[model samples]
Target: MAISFAQCFLAVDDHDKALAFYRDALGLEVRNDVEFEGMRWVAVGAPSQPDVEIVLEPPGAGPGASPADRRAMAELLAKGLLHGVNFWTDDCDADFERVRARGGEVLQEPVDQPYGVRDCAFRDPSGNMVRFVQPRGR
Candidate 1:
């Protein structure tokens, strides 16, 4: 049996604002934007990696989360405590410059990580940390 990663979700306060960063700044393609069950579902993916997708949805969107729970989730997202995904880039510096030029809030400049990959980070419009990493040799 084989398993592959499919989709991941990020809590977003506004769909359009998230799109501005993910689609415009990061250059990910907008794969889906539609309404489902009274909620908007938006998904974005790297054009080079069609198999993986990232979904941007509102906080506290889970069926079982109470209003208070949802509020807490939103607060966490606002505080930059949410766990956002990392992206692998061919050129970390180029990607960092591009994102920064587009007004992305820089969290860290590109630096060689002791762990092996060079990386940089930024805070998305909703304050989630989005990291771009390039393997040292690539």
Candidate 2:
């Protein structure tokens, strides 16, 4: 049987803020958000691409998570060091503007890359690193 990356989990300190960045700014679809016993399982994905989902999980969602690990995770998550997520777009400039309007910080403005693409980077509300790219050779 073949396998694929269905989704990736992001342990964030503020799930709501992360959700807003993904749903409101990038216009991703909210697939599921179920809460039980003061815990939640939330996710969002591209509207046209249902298989690619990002689950917004809590820092201590893992098994036997110690206080030190939680703190370390939180710190790394804030510095935009935990993960680097990238999306392909038709227009990087427009996407950057849209993200900026939604309160996402422009870590790097749109620029031509040596790899034959135009890209921009942003720091999401939860400090996650997101890169948007578009082909520039067209």
The top-ranked prediction according to lDDT is 1
TM-score of 2: 0.90
Candidate 2, clashing residue pairs? none
Residue 37, candidate 1: C-alpha displacement in angstroms: 4.5
The segments of candidate 2 whose C-alpha lies over 4 angstroms from its true place after superposition are none
* TM, every model: 0.96, 0.90
**Model 2 C-alpha lDDT per residue in residues 21-124, reported as the tens digit of each score:** 88898999899998775767798899878788988887667768888997888888877778768999998999999899888888999999898999999887
Writing each residue's lDDT as its tens digit, candidate 1 over 1-138 gives 999999999888889999999999999999999887776779999999999999999888889999899899989998989868799999999999999999999999999999999999999988999999899999
> What is each predicted model's overall lDDT from 0 to 1?
0.92, 0.85
Q: Using TM-score, give the best candidate's number.
A: 1
Clashes of 2: 0
Model 1 per-residue lDDT at 126: 89
What is model 1's C-alpha RMSD? 1.0
